[model samples]
Target: MIVDESIARPIAASEAHTIEADVAIVGAGLAGSLARAVLVRAGYRVVLIDKRTVPPDEFRVEKIGGRQLDLIRQLGFINDLEAVGAPYNRVLNIRDGKVVDISVGQAFGLSYASLVGMARGLLSDPTSFLIDQVTGISCSDDRQQLELASGKRVTSRLVILATGMASPLAYSLGIKRRMLAERHSVSFGFTIARPDNAPFEFDALTAYGERTADGVDYLSLFPIADGMRANLFMFRDPTDPIMRELRRDTKRTLLRLMPGLQRYLGDFDVVGQVQSWVMDLSVVEGHLQPGVVLIGDAFQTNCPAAGTGVSRLLVDVERLCTDHVPRWLETEGMGADKIAQFYSDQGKLAADRHSLDMARFRQALTLNNDARWSARRKLHFLRRMITHRVDRIHPGWVTRVRGALR
Candidate 1:
């Protein structure tokens, strides 16, 4: 799925006059950028507004695969993704010092900033992007207006709130983030390389905690352009001393948490700054207003360990940009009824519900100590191990049987 490679550059300082468009998306992150690309190519006068033209390096989704990859392909950016990301075909999964299973699939890894850049680069018209902070917004059924920090005005028929988590802009419009779960999960992002700067034994690997009490869900190691990136997801208190130890003596504490890692990974050095994030499971309330719609993290937050963030955002982008937004644009006024159609979209609803459900499921799987859950945890891995053994004995048998059943 390839589209036009040419991109419109960011708005120049002199060209930052009044911005006008059919849709004004506030936030130049993944959601906003992707939406702008789609709308602009569809011949809609779209303006993407954000504070930063160059997104800073941040600890966000560094790798994407499975349904995430499929969604990107559907969005017609698979070729662009291939150009910017490092791809791997196999992931060796281990737990309790033994192989659990081998996941064979396509995946890609890169920095979050690079991913955003790639999205922004999809713009066919450079002037469609405005690198300015939004200070105020006024929405109505017929039209919407925005006041920027630079005293410029942007008027559009519709507004998209994709400012992600912690948006004062959304709060200004009386949209509140209801915390479903606070400090739901803690995650770590960093890079690791062999002492000799060589590649690791595997192209990609994942090691789960031996004991549930350790609070670690898993350590996922994958190849990025820079090096092997490590994303450690855990269900632990952010203030715990173990968190400090992880930041200070990352390699040591990581090995201590998953001793089995050493046998497979040997000795590796953390090559870059250690980044961390504490995620809260939350959803937006009072967002069903005229002329404005919430998307991505602006609509709901996801548990990183669950690995549903990409899927959720992709669904938001795909359903809203490809389906609902176009239909709304063809009509007269952007009202609450029109906006509700997107929130009520079956695919969007399923993605949103699944993201929340997976968040809770992952947390429970990692931290629950109940007798039933403990038994479930054992059976989960046991099933994987058994299936892996069976597959090893007869290659492609699992695929044949599963496909036939389907």
Candidate 2:
């Protein structure tokens, strides 16, 4: 069912000037592609449109773990994910050149492109995908229409916008993004390997910032199919000279920022391009409408440092596709009232709220030098270190005590 992009043909090539479907998903990114697969497997006709046949190498969510893994399993895409991602079960957490704890869990590392590719490949019918741009959308309470640049049109009962941040298509529909925090965080992504091509001392590692002034949240190193991948997150100004240094002289500037990395990483060189992204924390307004709904970054944007983007999108996908869409389709119309239900869904609301909350929490924890925050930061790490030591000594004592307390 994995359609090769090289041999993939547009649905328009079949001499069909118009297509009809139960759902039309715009933007074949992670969210749209996954939504299409879910709906298709559920016996709904889905038409997915995107400009690119192949997902370009982009600096986006490059790893999946924690609740994200659980959501993927719940959506039945874990096997597809496992086929494309490299797995790591332990991450050595360190601060100030010392071991704070070891986080044991299942996580996968892969390029965002491969991740999206895997999702798109889950479609049993390759002809459902359209490699073209959406020029216009006309929506009503009963049905919606999409005008593609290829001069073809698609009519569907429901439309899902997964076009991501700064979507001109959403803006054209009068859906505006309200900036909660502009330039909220800066993130760097790249691969690294020792000169001798040897693996690192640990299966995975996380080096926390040594000083609040450094504005570094953490540097996470994990395994990908290509090599060891590194993600450096910071709360500093995107325009700072350090940003330039990190890109130009990655290893040296990285070592200078967190000297402790030298011990664990040893002598390593950054492989391939160093991709950087400055994120803005924002959410959509005026999105409630007939025949349409927004999901993923189209609805809200998340701070990369918070690691909540994937979880939020997965929640959006799960709630809308599995719970909301099926029921909505069975009913008469796709109205603002019906669309409002998804926006008000408790699970979606919580995920959206949690992503923003964690965004602010991470920024404050990294750069807030106020006496109260400083003390709080110290206590946070100290608590983790203590718990890790205790767990190591007594094994299941912490788990048992936590269970009893709960």
Candidate 3:
């Protein structure tokens, strides 16, 4: 594993004026950093560039579990992830003050900055990272060039845009974002602590919204290094008055919206700043160009409420770095024909489609008051509650039945 390599050795300032590599990635976030690590370990000379020296304290994805953890292990970074993140194996799921089901699995919680930092630290050659804004980019089937803000230039055989939701550079290349849904969902992030600074009774907890009128999907509370981190996902309008109230008086607003949470939380106060994001579900058009490729949020945005953002980006990184890029590098040119193979990959296409579908399903389940959806909403919780009860009564019975059906 790359983690066993010596610590990163940064390049001198003088040697960075002109750089060359087989691949030049424009963003050093999780997606870009992971790509650089994978390519470098495969013996490809890769350069990763970002304007910020340190990843900003952003309120992005804060937890990884399930398929996300599987992908991390597949990339050989599970040990590194366990080192930096706080892990929990059980999550008590509840709705309207009653237990729905208990989710048992390995998961980790950490801030976005720390997560990106872990990815960046995987590169033994820190010199491959450039801290300068890209002023312009020009690409062709044979090669690509990038102009930097510090008067440096980077020449490479391929360029990858993992710039997240920002699209200025992609726009310059005639690529545009096509909004599928505007103001599709809103999310809130913050930390909470008990009055006495004591630990909560459960390992982790998820409280689902009791009423459709509240517009809330769920409130997830998990343990980070500092304290319990809270992520509240909603389908409400971003401009609603409740949004302001949630920011100003978080604890009170949360209790009023989901009264069942009070019994579980037991007099907790909101700590630090409350960060919120309004997401517009979108994807890029006209991105199939020579010498350039889009991945992660640079290519598409997902509804945070659905919890599919990390899953989609991890799929993008695994498929591009492991399967597509190597095959493209074996050939002479980085043409659209080669780049098209990645977009058409079965695994990539399935992930992208599943993200969009999950986003729409979460919104309908949370806010739709139609007769059919209402019945489904009830059955959803009821089914889980019944299964949980049966599991307690007959240990391993549910697992045996599910395995037989599969």
Error of 2 at 303 (Å): 0.4
User: Each model's RMSD to truth, in Å?
Assistant: 3.3, 4.1, 3.0
Local accuracy of candidate 1 as per-residue lDDT tens digits, 1-406 = 2222222223334355666678889999988898988877766777898999698788998999999999999999999999999999899999988999999999999999999999999865677887788999999999999999888898888999999998998999999989999999999999998889866789899998788899999999999999999999999999999999999999999999999999998878988799999999999999999999999999999999999998999999999998888788776999999999999999999999999999888888888999999999999999999999999999888999999999
**Pairs with backbone N, CA or C atoms under 3 Å apart (clashes), candidate 3:** none
Pairs in clash, predicted candidate 2: none
Model 1: lowest-lDDT 10 consecutive positions? 1-10
- Regarding lDDT, does 1 or 2 come out ahead? 2
Q: Candidate 2, residue 115: CA error in Å? A: 0.3
lDDT of 2: 0.91
| RMSD value for candidate 3 | 3.0
Off by more than 4 A, model 3: 1-16
Candidate no. 3 TM-score: 0.96
- Computed on alpha carbons, the lDDT of every model, listed in order, comes to 0.90, 0.91, 0.92
Residue-wise C-alpha lDDT for candidate 3, range 316-354, written one tens digit per residue: 999999989888887699999999999999999999999
